[model samples]
Target: MKISLKKTDLFVGIYLLSAVMFFIISIPSWLLDFLLAFNLSVALIVLFNALFAKEVLDMASYPTILLFTTIFRIGLNVSSTKLILRDGDAGKVVLTFGQFVGGGNLVIGIIIFIIIIIIQFIVINKGSERVAEVTARFTLDAMAGKQMAIDSDLNTGAITDKEAAEKRKKLQQENAFFGSMDGATKYVKGDATAGLIITGINLVGGIVMGMLYSGLTVNEALNKYTILTIGDGLSSQIPSLLISLATGILVTKASSDGELGDEIVGQLFSIDKVLMMVGAALVVMGLFTPLPNYIYIPLGIALIVVGRRLKKRTGVEAIEEEVEESEAEAQEIRKPENVVNLLNVDPIELEFGYGIIPLADVNQGGDLLDRVVMIRRQVALELGAVVPIIRLRDNIQLNPNQYIIKIKGIQVSDGEILFDHYMAMNPGYVEEEITGIPTFEPSFHLPAIWITESQRERAESLGYTVVDPPSIIATHLTEIIRQHISELLTRQDVSNLINNIKDNNQALIDELVPKLLGIGEIQKVLQNLLSEGISIRDLVTIFETLADHASVTRDTDILTEYVRQSLKRAISGKYFPSNETTSVVTLDPNIEQEIMSSVKNTEQGSYLSLDPERTKKIMASTGSELKKLEDMGKNPIVITSPIVRLYFKKLAVDYYKDIIVISYNEVESNVELQSVGMVTA
Candidate 1:
């Protein structure tokens, strides 16, 4: 049998096992010296690793390393203390360190040992402990916000699921790593205190042993034991100091893109002007003050030379970079595939100017992006439309406060707003007046006043509808979306909606989709409903109704009418108030007959074919009735016979693009309708 042990595993096992072995069994001085040297090398390696790592999590097991190394160092201290007390010699490593550092002087070695203890214990270890504590606390607190940012990016398609998963994993590891470090810092603190206590014990116990067993004089024993204790102290404390310094550096290091040395040099000397100013100041100090002219003048001149060279190098690099960038851009534009990328346009875009950027920027406490997200949800719920991702960007050409909304890359509407002002509009009942800047509400084109924050309370108290800039923008955006939603509905959108239904109600989709009507036809029917601001959330009912009627007539217009009649409840709820009589206009019977008679049937579908003179008279009468309804403060609704409803709607769309033309069958029995006027030709 062959044992195949990995080097890392075997090394770690021996290391940990040796820590225990030092406590259990006695080791010779040669092995102790070798272990002491190995310990120093490991400590140096840890310090270098911590210094160069770009991210703290790159050494996620640092806390565990601290634990294992502290234990091993303590074991070495115990073994060395035993050797000094029992045998008057620890090792050549400890003896040489004490003699070389002390220069064969007793007091200097002790003083040096104490100074090391003070610096490590008071400065590095204590500061590292606090930093680790704060870092762990902050990491735990920020986890939620970071996770939300990841989710927001995922929703916006800014990052993939894989990237998000990796971010989440890194976040979790950061949390655990810092938490472990918070506790691990305590080990280093205790190790320092333990080293101090064990050094005292070795000094006192060595003096007693030397006097009684070696028959040395009190002075000889004191000098001999003191030197050995200081040696042992220096040997152990030096490594401990290095370990604490590593901990301090690791915890205090801010995240950077490169090694510690490189980042430090790049940032400290990046500004040539600062360097030149410092060099000039040093020269002045060297000449005018008591500071050494030999050292300062040469160093100052060297810095000045380096500054000039760096400045020239930086200027050359900037010019070269600019030239490279322009050439690369020209090459990119000439590429056929890259040119094609420029032609693609966003479906919906909200582009503003520089002045409005703060309102759209989340870091500046702007909720416009959040409000936009909510608008998508609101539209989906109310109109059953999957709104495309809305693109937001700043335009330099427009006025500072002006914003433009674009649909399929065409500018449709725009509005200007004041940042810190409120828009106050009287909802028809406010008798009180307030001093404010006069404006018009962009959404409804109603007269409004831009009032200061101070006047917002009084405006609301006076029964005026007070809104902020963000609400004004959101409302305008919602209205624009509602008006163009029909055109925005695409075949892909219809397919997604169909697939939603197919998830649970596959039978209805399979029957109505391709068997009776294709996706394009279904899209038209849905668009017809959306065009009139009808909710299509009830896809099951709509698809079932389509299946029942699609077999009879494949014409989308007639099929839309059938679907509308099937959704009478929703239609009535949307257009007419429940348990209330709504005043509307009724199409005259003569005009309804004329509309049906002139309907022209083609292979594709049926359309109204009334002559110009007759069509003019019909539109005039329809406009007159709509005027009467508007004057009476009623919605401009026209009720017609089910057969003529579709034709009349198509004919009047040119004149009243937002006209509500419904058939008698499209009204539920619960809806109370009062005919206040008539449309006659």
Candidate 2:
């Protein structure tokens, strides 16, 4: 969720108050101080526990940790710097502030903090691996399969106008409530106000408790005002606003759910009045707090107020009421419960969890046994549990992208085991057992090719197993990889990869230049395929996998040539046909005079012959010109017509012999027309 100004203001307010409370409490003596520290430690323990239990770690606390360290060091500097006035103590050695805290020190601290923040960011950005696992484990009522109902508008039914209105109201409510939770969690987690509250409560409470415990009168405890003031003064220096903001920012950004509440608090409490009140309180308490116990009571109360204020301001209760109304409306829309019987769909409940496969001796033969053993060992070592291997098969064709293999196993762990040797066993086993396996079944026969040590190792390390015997699995694997590689190796993007190789090795030009020159046909095929709506990303992925596999040890030039030839063949066969019928123009002289009359132009004294059918068309067209003249003259002035006159004056007067225009094709060029024209009366 994007943070709104309202949220930011609330955060600022809560932070200010929390900061004051926290700082003030730190100055006072308190019984809960140790408990609070323990709680913080327990929280850390929980977070670390999650790291192992979760597929993805929640990294939000890391930044807070660094920020806390920095602020904590700065806030308590005065108390730390004060030297003890012990009897016979050596004279104090005066030192410059730079010696204790200089520009270099600040720079170093910032860099450390930045590094911690970045590490946490990377850790958190990886999507919740734990969500899937936790959902499976904790959400026992919910099944682990995706909802696959196909929604048709008519059958699914649309929401009623009433429901829609209710939904709007509910959404507004949840947004507000969730926002309130956001600010409250931040204040409670780690801010100076929390500390100040602890300090004030602890101070007053401690004085009371100490008086009770030591049998000192209340007046005696009151006499230690100077000491209390000193402690409060030290506490006041701790910036409650800065600490709260830092913590809130960390929690907001780090939580799996976006920190809506943090933003809300930051916005609400950021006003000058709130800051002034909180700041003044922190400064006063920190300087005056003698006993720590009194600080916490006030700090806790302040937090309760901060939280309550945000909740009230945001109107979360109203929102919840509104949401309840909406949900009720939605319930009315859903059809009354109906028992729909399903056939041939006995679903098995599968529990899924991340298994960390420890590396065995990679030098072991990259075989099925070795791979399975490696996976088993790794799982055991990581979880401090032994897992039973359900079954193992070899030569299975899995996804080309990841050497995915289905391993049916259960984790049983309460002890530590070694994993280093497990990884080492995969490559060695691949060479011995996996490569030369023979055909397993009638339907699953396949081919075997040279497998790179790295490829074998990668396959084994990932616990990939062939589901079928060697021969049968080989064919399936080949077909799968072939389909993917064929699509990928023939793409336009491949040209970019080619360019990179070409710059370093001009030999590529000699290798693939012919293929490059003749890529137009292949490009045409790809376009046709694209037009047919084949997925481009799928094509790219297949090619990228092929390229990655090739990177294992294949000759770059040879692979390039191979891809080019394959593409050339696919293009030639798929789109362009070599033996296609050539279109030709043909003319029948028998209907020439009749056809010529249609054009309204036919005046011919002689005809010419030309090679091929094309020349015949030209000659036939000329004869039509004479017919055109005959048609145009209503009086039938056959001798006086311009076309007839031109033909007779130009051809009949001069060279009575016929001329034939013969060109490339074997069509006769007016030869038959000339023969007829010369014999004409």
By TM-score, the best candidate is 1
Model 2 RMSD in angstroms: 27.6
Off by over 4 Å in 2: 1-76, 79-255, 258-477, 499-681
Please provide, for model 2 over 284-396, each residue's C-alpha lDDT reduced to its tens digit, 9 standing for 90 to 100: 66557754636744664575566557556568667988999999989977857545642322111111111211121123422323433344355334322223322322112
TM-score of each: 0.67, 0.22
lDDT by residue for model 1 over 134-193, one digit each (tens)?
999998999987886765565445776699899999999989999999999999999999
For candidate 2, the per-residue lDDT at 605 reads 20
Which model scores highest in lDDT?
A: 1
The Cα local distance difference test for each model comes to 0.89, 0.33
Error of 1 at 63 (Å): 3.4
Candidate 1 stretches greater than 4 Å from native: 1-31, 79-89, 133-183, 205-228, 270-293, 308-337, 353-355, 361-367, 373-388, 396-402, 407-421, 433-440, 444-457, 478-681
